[model samples]
Target: MTRTLYLFGSAAPPVFDVARVIEDAQSGGWDVCLGLTPTAADWLGEGLDGLAALTGHPVRSSYKRPGDPDVWPAADAVLVAPATFNTINAWALGLTDRFIVGVVAEGIGKGIPLAVMPCVNAAYVQHRAFERSVRELREMGVTVLYGEGGFVPNLPGQGRKEAYPWDLALTAMDDLVPKREA
Candidate 1:
């Protein structure tokens, strides 16, 4: 049985390369469903359709209306890559204002295996909320690859977009819920 992976992205530089990441997830034997933060959707702009086509699922950035059928299949695992400072804090606090945050927050209660890799700078890391958020998420059984062997903070205004650990996040997701052979 093919496993479905919900890959959610925030408005970090790595989000620009989400199409390639989706392909990578697919190659790893997952049916990829893409979801993005509002800013990420806007940033993706014209490429949204292309990403949708690539994943064979709509790139959702908003919640469907009440009673509307879910477009994507049930997720066997969730990977939140390039999570921004705001995204991490909001998720840790259970603030579901954003579509991606909402699903991930609920995914926890539903017991869906989840992993997140935060893409933040050194300045953002100094914020007290950031550390608390990471701790909270980890306490909730969420695999947070924030430091060492995961995503280390770069200096502000000096982000190495190319260096974001998309592979590491994908690997963590695979570890959370590996695909089962038919």
Candidate 2:
């Protein structure tokens, strides 16, 4: 069975990088579901159509569609790359404002492993609430992949001294999938 991976996050520089990661995962034969934050959708452009083409699955951004009876597939794992500080806090507090949060909450309830790659400003990253939320997520058994540095826009030499490798992210997602018994 192909493992379902739910990708969620905010609009940051690493979002482009995250797209590459998703492409790699698709090439590796994983079924991918993308849920973008409003801000993320804006930055990503093309309204997930490109992502849908890449993954061959419908990319969901909202939960307000009427008569959309297709049940979201149970995810084998959840990856929140380029996770904004706002998203981190919302997830930590169980806020279900959007499709991404709803799916993540559902996955957590089902005990699915969740991997979060946080990319935000240094000030926000050091905020007490953000720090506390990170601790809480860790306690909840979510694997937090810490990205180095903030995603500053239009600033030369100011973001991610070493960006998280796409392959490493894919490997982490693969690790969450259970090996089938032969």
Candidate 3:
């Protein structure tokens, strides 16, 4: 079976540059599954449809459809980029109200590799709860990229001055791609 990577995050940057990331994964012979938070879908506008088309798979946002065969993919790794404070806290606490968090919780529990890229203000990042959560996730073996050491809104053409590592988001996927079975 093809290794699957679950993409989770909020839609902040208008040009989040996800197409190339998806294409790269496909080229690596891995299946891509996308899960968008409600706020993310709103910010993405029509970009969500474009992502679905690119991956040839429907993007999931909620956990209401548990019986759907396609609700969750057999992901080999889960990458939560542009991960909002709310999403991070929710996932850390094991609240699976949304599809993305649900799948992440499931994946982690099942021993699948997981990576998180938190995208929130530095103040929020320093919160004790957030710190504890990050530590807990690490203890659970999840790779938390922890944004680029500060808080910055995701905007295109802003250079690499922001705290978030947009480029590393894709690079993390490269790290997660499974080796072909001999």
Candidate 4:
């Protein structure tokens, strides 16, 4: 059976390229559903409709009211690409003030496999909370693609949008699923 992948995004600039990420996830045999942080949703602006079409689901940015039925299918995997510094810190603390964070917090509690690729600058990564968050999330069984082999930090004011390690996050998700021997 094909697995459902929830592609979550933050306000980082790279979240604009989420269509490409959706394509990648789809090519990997996953049915993609997207949820963006509020800021990221605003950033999408006119492009939001296109993304919704690509995923065949509404691009959700807020939580539905209580007593509302589930809008999307259960997620088999979750990828938070362009995960911002604030989002990282908030998610690490299990804060769920927004839709994306709520999904992340719930996903973790439900033991859903999660892979995150944070898009903060080099200086941002030096913040105590950033490192601590990465460690904390990892301990929670979230696959944080960071350090040498995963996401290499870029200098502040010199963001490398073209070079973000989207592949590694996908690979991490692939690693989460056990492969059947051919």
TM-score of each: 0.98, 0.83, 0.80, 0.95
Candidate 3 residue-wise lDDT, 1-182, digit = tens: 57778877675552265666678767776688777888777766687888998887877777754565655467778888777778778888999878788878888879888888776665565668888887888888888886444234444344342434655665666676655674
lDDT of each: 0.93, 0.72, 0.72, 0.87
The candidate 1 region of ten consecutive residues with least summed lDDT is: 172-181
Cα shift from native, residue 166, model 3 (Å): 3.7
What's the ranking of the predictions by lDDT, best on top?
A: 1, 4, 2, 3
Ten contiguous residues minimizing lDDT sum, candidate 3: 154-163
Candidate 1 stretches greater than 4 Å from native:
none
Off by over 4 Å in 3: 147-163
User: What would the per-residue lDDT of candidate 1 be over residues 1-182, giving only the tens digit for each residue?
Assistant: 78899999999999988888988889999999999999999999999989999999999999999999999999999999889999999999999989999999999999999899999999999999999999999999999998888999999999988999888988888888877979
Distance (Å) between predicted and true CA of 177, model 4?
Answer: 2.3
Candidate 1: pairs in clash:
none
* True-structure lDDT of candidate 2: 0.72
RMSD to truth, every model = 0.7, 3.6, 3.7, 1.7
RMSD of candidate 4 to the truth, in angstroms, is 1.7
- List candidate 2 segments past 4 Å from native: 64-67, 147-157, 160-162, 178-182
Report the C-alpha lDDT of model 4 over 67-170, residue by residue, as the tens digit.
99877898888998889899999999989998888888898889899888889998998889999999999999898888887877889988868788888888
lDDT value, candidate 1, whole model: 0.93
Number of backbone-clashing residue pairs for each candidate, in the order shown:
0, 0, 0, 0
